[model samples]
Target: MNSKHQILVIGAGTGGLMMASRLKKEHKDFDIAIIDPAKTHYYQPAWTLVGAGTYDFEDTAKPMADLIPKGVKWYQDKVTAMDPDSNSVSTEKSGEIKYDYLVVSPGLTYDMSLVPGLSEAIDKGNVCSNYTDPKHTLEVLKNFKGGTALFTQPTTPIKCGGAPQKIMYLAEAYFKKHGLKDKTNVVFATNGTVIFAVPEIKETLMKIVDRKNINLKFYHALKRIDAEKQIAWYELAPEAYEHNPAKLEIEKEGNMVGIHYDMLHLAPPSVAPEFVRKSKLANAEGWLDVDHHSLQHNKYPNVFGLGDVAALPTAKTGAAIRKQVPVVLDNIEKLMKNQAADNKKYNGYSSCPLVTEYGKMVLAEFDYDNKFTPDPELKKMLIFDSSKEHWRLWILKKYGLPYLYWNKMLKGQDV
Candidate 1:
């Protein structure tokens, strides 16, 4: 095997695979290689549906072997260290690899330790998370005995910001189906003040929150969980703490409070992978330090990043990866040819299909400024109003996006 290559991709997840495939389609003869130890590549967007028991868990995964682009050498090994200054990467199995350009997209790591007792609580049936295991989530929903079901969002950045609530909405629908709606006390506890960032979708979700009679606890972040005792602990946000204490009840240990629950669904705290987090390449927030517009490293011109790992101020989602792919590829091509780069710039575009109910979704698409930027293809054709809940968007979320991911994006079609 060659020690040096024209391009080296660090992770074979959505971003790396898409970038490699696109590069392959454009430059068939380019010396490209991808390093990853994963045997299976998962279509993570469908996990929500899987958790809701609407989609099969098996359908969300594919062998990594089947997805790698033709002629792109695959190193099935985990990366240990990156020496960008020496233009080389060190892997566990393959000692050293040199590259003219590097692409880092290992994605985030789940920090189960962020919330005390989270690791031990997840296996206890009553506490399940859709973020990690969709099957467990289904099991939890099926075995629900009906009481106060608590859905929580952590304070840290998470992939698919709408996911914490998406499953809750699905659980609500499930309760209605099984005649448990009356007995179920549905509560959504999140640290964020608003239900959603986009105004149009937030307005729509507010209506759903009211109509469904779901409890909305704003400025409440999950602090810990006593799974054995069926107690979920929370700490009030700074704003809430600063507000009049006359109305709010404070616990003896400061602003802590507890909610008794029959079932607890939590969104685990997410952070950059340990390898990336400990590296000098990472920013203050422990994410890849890259220019938001060009997708290039702020310090090193040869380094590029995208997807969940990059410090781009956008909601991390597969839809966001689709938008980031083109910009990274364009810049890489220019840099490879020794031409002045920066022609293509990413606009911080990300889309989150907020599944409000069964067969209904509000496709929230936006840019850096949090302004609604609907897909031009759908917007021009007037297929559906993305900001409103529609069955068409739900179909796209269920069927269309997965098809596009496997057949188009990873195959280098760029659409």
Candidate 2:
């Protein structure tokens, strides 16, 4: 109603809500507002479990109304334009709202058009994607008769870098459970050159790949899919194209390898939201241009960005956001206090709980250098080595993280 605020946050996803709730707890006197049209906030990390039928879909979501921090005015409308130069944002119905500081964590959107037939093939027939609808993926898995069970990801960045593979591992377990493992060929064809970046984690995953007999076709990017013909064509990576022709099986069609599949699950190409991509705050890559260490905008001192929307070198994950939020908060508080250039730095820390199989998980925690830096606290108190498959890690994924997210992170509690 005031058409103004001291600080305004965009999006109501993980990063946006976390920042807002904590700001509320610390700066109760500051007039803050958040703009988002979402009715329900989802714990998307659990969808990997949901797709495997290991977790309930309903448990992954909560009404957004219950989560947005109290006293932080909520604008239940989408942002049409973000004019940071003018220090104002235009909403679809609320007209213009001004802010002294803007927090952009609107997250990314699926660019289904990246691959020609991706829009038509996703969630259609044998093609299923947990990113779009985990429930639909479950149904697709239920009716899977058995053959080539292939999983792949887009060349572009996607939230949860390991998500595409997480489902593959879980689905493999499903196949083994229903006596279809013998008849099915499990394959992961990714554009990434390695199974995982961290060495210890990669070693752990490589073992799982061997045990499950899952195929890993690195340097293979999905080019297109012929839904009617049950064919998924792939373009070989540069290494395969110019150097190693043996990278692809010679028996397959030349140039583009067209593989036949019974089921295809993939992470589609994703980009910053249209509103963020088109805004002045976005980088050339269409993501918010923020300092990798401070989580502050490169050009604007009063503007901050985080979550999947920020163009940071680390993986776009909720775990990364956990480290980023505090840095953003500290910098914002310093600015509010007229403290110049005094800021906190994020070490680009992010964690990915790689669920190798049912009752088994490998925690991959690292910094900017791709070092296998386990959480010092966890390494000392919890399990010693995070890279090894631990049943306790599986419990953390299934129960611990979700409980912490809803109770601690969003509620502005440190623990």
Candidate 3:
């Protein structure tokens, strides 16, 4: 069915749902329709907590129909193609749908093929990923017999840059809880040299790492996994050791390191959806190419993007979208009225609640420059310093954030 809307939003995710909810609240008369095929919308941020066995997986989701804001139309259809030049999109069930303005925020997807054996090994034995199957992560952690427990992330950008480490910290805490701490060799093999981009947060995480005695193997990118053999192979980046990326015959001769593990938890490599990647809206990296500040398409002003789909040089997070939604909504209003921006630019603000242990957390907030800028309002009301691990922050993470997400953010209240 061919249809046209004043504002067409893709994906009822944090970006799409919030955009529709906020806009509908202010501009009730506007014709807005959101497209998403899913029946349930999952709060992915809480998956880390689920993997740690603290939060129930079922609590992380709700009926998408329940969350769709009143007065906003919802289309249970998947986006197969996006055509910004024509200001239209093609859906799986629906035919070509035209729009005056398009909001492209179809979130990223994971491809286990990016890493060998990742798909086959998922949830079968000790191999588990919080992003894919968080429930199985809980099982893996519970069944751990205490050996080398390796946690790693791919080089490709994944949902919430801190997620990989969050699960790592939680798994370590779980091991400690089960009295497996002494027998377990907790190794964090990450592609990055630093614990975190933000300096203050990095310092805090480092302290936690030292206290837990977790070994940090810097610049180690997960290349492949032999799940059957219970071995994970990693490729070492040359910059870390001042060598070159080389592959010879064996692990000792090459830049590869294989570690056998009794338990392995990993964050799978993820990328933008194929439809957005092949479209004209995509950047060189296959993500929606939008102005980082305005969240407007670089080439098409009628288009806006946010959330994990946007190719911004920052973490893909719901916290980032909280800041981005206002900028996008403000700009959309201005463009409709005068086709000009009112200095409403996003500062690339994203916050990650790094759960160091079962009871402590560090609220790592930062901007485009990786500056550790804590929320002044939070500091004034809650904790003054977010650089240190605090039980109060953990309480906020486990309870407060989810409340704000559903009742405040999705319910069309200012967050």
Candidate 4:
């Protein structure tokens, strides 16, 4: 009910929740309030396995009420408009709230409707996307039998770039397990020219694709889906125009082609929310305009952001948020004390446990410069191999991660 607070955190997702919980633990004087419309908190990383039938959907989600940090004010309302200059944000249910400091981490929006016939295909069976709601995952997987199953990644920046292919790999493993490998054809259709960003990882992925006999289609963008005919239309690059062959040249540039598919797994385009997108604080790419080092708003000093919505030029994942939480908290604490904070920079450290199969994963850890930051210490401490396809990594992903996320990361307990 109070409209004023020392700090207002928009969204109760990983970033927002982490920031609020950390701030509450560090500074008792500051009144912290969190606004979110959702009633559940999902460990989104687990959805890949859920789609693959490896993990139960129920295990990936938890009640929002139980997750909110103790003593912090919780407002279950959607943010309608955010006015950075006035230090106020309006909500759908609760009119307006004013704050001394604001943290925007509402997360990105998944625009599935942008793809033609995608909605119908998903409803009609034969198409599923693990990047969205988990309820439909089981239905889609159950219907998949023996046919050309296509997995696609959009050109736009996504929350977890590796996630699209992770599910594909899982499906490939599932087909093999169920004795349908020979009958079914698996394909990864991506706009990117390479499988993985890191050269080391890409090399491994290429071997896996070849060994498994999975078709890899690059520079092909998903155009439309004909669910009825089970035909997915894709425009290949280097498309030539008949009217002006010499003057116009090739539009697609040797990359124009089309392919039909029996089944499709679509990854929708993602972007910052309209409120954040339209705001001046957003970058040209429509992400929170923040210093990559400070995680503070480039324009508004009192505002800060992290996680998927931030304009940090790195893969958006919860692992990135784990490293960012402390930096943001320290900076905010120092600012509140009217003291200059030490420039503790974040090197865009993000991890993607690339699950190549049900029991295998390539723990890809890298920073902003695309350099490996392997946790050899973790391997030594746990007494396990850090290589791809280890049961230890699988257990870490299945049980260890969710526990760490809830008890440590969200609670602001530094490990």
TM-score of each: 0.95, 0.95, 0.96, 0.92
Q: In model 1, where do residues sit more than 4 Å from their true spots?
A: 241-253, 379-382
Can you write out model 3's per-residue Cα lDDT over 284-341, one digit (the tens) per residue?
A: 9899999888988889989999799999999888999999999999998988997685
Instruction: Please give the CA lDDT of all the candidate structures.
Output: 0.87, 0.87, 0.87, 0.79
Clashes of 4: 11
What's model 1's TM-score? 0.95
Clashing pairs in 3: none
Model 4's alpha-carbon lDDT is 0.79
**TM-score, structure 2 vs. true:** 0.95
Over 1-415, each residue of candidate 4 has an lDDT whose tens digit, in order, gives 4399988998899998888888888777679999999999999999888888778888888999998988899999988888898899888888889998888899999776666777777644667788775457657667667777778877778988899888888888888888888877787777777787777777777777877778776767777666776766666655322210111111232344445566678777788998888887788888999989888898898888989999998999999998888888888888888976455688899988888877877777888987767777566546244534566778788888888998998887884
- How many pairs collide in each candidate, listed in order? 0, 0, 0, 11
Please write out the lDDT profile of model 1 over residues 1-415, one tens digit for every residue.
3389999999999999999999999999999999999999999989999999999999999999999999999999998988889998888888899999999988888998999989899856789888899899899999997888889978999999999899999899999999999888888877888888888888888888877888888898888888887888888877642211112222334788887888888889999988888887899999999999888999989999989999988999888889888888888888878886685568889988889889988888998889988886876435567888788888888998899999999998868
Instruction: Write model 2 residue lDDT over 82-182, tens digit each, in one string.
Output: 89899999999999999999999888889989888889889877899999999889998999998888899989999989999999998999999999988
Clashing pairs in 1: none
